[model samples]
Target: MKVKVQSLDGGKPGKDIELSDEVFGVEPRADILHRVVTWQLEKRRGTARGARERSDVARTGKKFGRQKGGGTARHGDRRAPIFVGGGKAHGPRVRDFNPSLNKKVRMLGLRMALSSKARDGNLVVVDSLDVKEAKTKALKERLGTLGLGRTALVIDGDALSVGFALASSNLREINLMPAVGANVYDILNHDTLVLTRAAVEKLEARFNG
Candidate 1:
């Protein structure tokens, strides 16, 4: 598939760039995307800190009071639930939330995510992110002209352009990422997916090479 290349410096649209069929032409599957997203979210979950139980509490095991006719009921130890500093009756246990997914499935889901954006016309290509002025106001005007909608995810080559990065830093609706950081979740979370010319080369090479 081919996508028109644009510039962030505000100029006429440039030539079209060809996208890899294997990476940008796959049929998106809801189930596959769901699984990958689920795995990613699960990995981000923090382990629940468990509280001390009766057996875990550091208390004496000696019996409490007289077991006969002392009026009070017989008790086991200071670790019992009735005691003031006693351990909890029931508590949660620490658990690992991370889950594993097949490597092939993970890669496939990413391809489908890219393809979905391409098929939906939400994918955009840019010539470069270089700008004469790195001011936020100037960038806003140029990007607004591109019709990138409400939110966009822009991916560049190895590192982001210093000037462009500074300009777009405060724009909450615009997210920037390097080519190596591309993944399924962030790609699909945005209204538009913009790839720079250098980013396109590296992305295609990542899968083909």
Candidate 2:
């Protein structure tokens, strides 16, 4: 598909970019997208959550009462789950939430996400641009020119552009990421996917490989 290239000033560059059908025009697979999103979210968990079990609780091991009821419910130690301030019963534990998906499936999901964006007219291609100095104001102005508010993801294929990255870091609605660092969530969460022409090519190459 052909898309018009725009400049930072939002002016048409009098040129257009040809997007790869294999990457941006594929049929979106919702199932694959769901799996990829789930995996990405799971991998982000810290797995540090823990709850005290009966053994971990500080309490005397002596039986609080006889096993048979004596005009009251039979009771165990103070650490029993039924008691207040006692150890949690079947509570959450520290464990991995990561879900393993095949490498091919991951790639497919990424492609589907990209295609979904393209189909929805949320993807835009721009001529390669760089920021000589880290300036959030300049970045904001540039985005303003393009009429993009809300969440925006900027993808660049060149070596790390620290200035550009830093400029967009403070903008809550803007996220700067290299082509190699692009992920499923980053692509789907943003309202706009701004890609430098080179970044689009790099992404296609990476996924189509």
Candidate 3:
């Protein structure tokens, strides 16, 4: 796909960039996308979740009462799951939720995400962005020039310019990341995908390499 490169002022860059078909033209797989997204979210969980099980609860192993009670139902240990403040049965425990997915699936998921963005006209290309100092105002102005107000993801080919990263650090709606760090969540979360010409080339190479 051929897309016009825009300047920071939203004006045409006097040049256009041709995106690769392999990277931005793949058919989206909803199932893979869903699985990948779920995997990503699961991997972020902390190992703090815990629950007391029957074995963990303190209770005498001896019979609390005769196997057959006189009037009431047979009684067991105080830590039985039925009793209040007793240990939980088959409750959630601290463990990993990560699912194993093939590397090819992951790559396809990313490509599909990019393709979806491209098809929806949510992707934008720019020649380059230069920021001498790390200032949020400067980044905000740049985004305004592009007429991107809602959540935006800025992708740079190499290491993010120190100034640009600093400027975007405080903005919750704007995210700046290097090409290597790009992920499905960031791409889908933003209302628009802003890519520099070099960034686009680098992304294609990484995916098609």
Candidate 4:
């Protein structure tokens, strides 16, 4: 499909770029998109939470009460779970929360996400993205003129320019990522998608390579 390329400053229409049908024309599958998003969020989880168990408590192992004379249940050590300051019986342990998905499925999910954006007219292509300096206000105003939405993702090919990255740093709603960082989760999370000419080429190579 052919999409009109626009300038970054005023969003004036320039030339048209042809998008690969395979990458930008696939049929969107909600199930695949869901799985990919879930996997991404799961992998970002920090499994650092820890709980002290019975063996980790620093307490004496001496018996608490007489075996038969005590009216309550027989007690072993002060560190038992039944005690107030005792360790937890069954508690959460530090572990990985990352979920795994097939590489092909992940790729498919990305394509589907891109296709969905294209179908919904939320995808746009820009000639380039260059900032004279790392001025966030200027960049924000430029992006606003383009009607790129308050929350949007700007993707560029290869390495992201330092000036562009810094200019967008203060924009909490706008996220800038390299083409390699493109994923189903970010594509679907944002309200609009802005891709540079180089970014579109990189995306085509990625899926068609």
Rank by TM-score, descending? 1, 4, 3, 2
Which candidate comes out best when scored by lDDT?
1
Tens digit per residue, CA lDDT, model 3, 63-97: 67777646767867788888877889998788876
lDDT of all the models against the reference? 0.91, 0.84, 0.82, 0.89
- Candidate 1 has a TM-score of 0.92
Kindly report which residue pairs in candidate 2 clash with one another: none
Ranking by lDDT: 1, 4, 2, 3
TM-score of each: 0.92, 0.75, 0.76, 0.82
lDDT of 2 at 192: 92
Q: Model 4, which residues run further than 4 Å from truth?
A: 10-14, 55-74, 82-86
After the best TM-score superposition of candidate 2, give how far the Cα of residue 52 lies from its true spot, in angstroms: 8.3
| Candidate 2 per-residue C-alpha lDDT over 1-209 given as tens digits, one digit per residue, 9 for 90 to 100 | 99988886445574888999989998997888999999999889888679998888998878877777567787768888988878899887889777789998999889888899899898988886565557888778887877564888889895756777778788888887789988899899999999998899899899767
Model 3 lowest lDDT segment of ten: 7-16
Q: Runs in model 2 with CA error above 4 Å?
A: 9-14, 49-92, 132-134
The TM-score of candidate 3 is 0.76
Name model 1 segments beyond 4 Å from true: none
With a 3 Å backbone cut-off (N, CA, C), the pairs that clash in candidate 3 are none
Instruction: TM-score winner between 1 and 3, please give it.
Output: 1
> Model 4 TM-score?
0.82
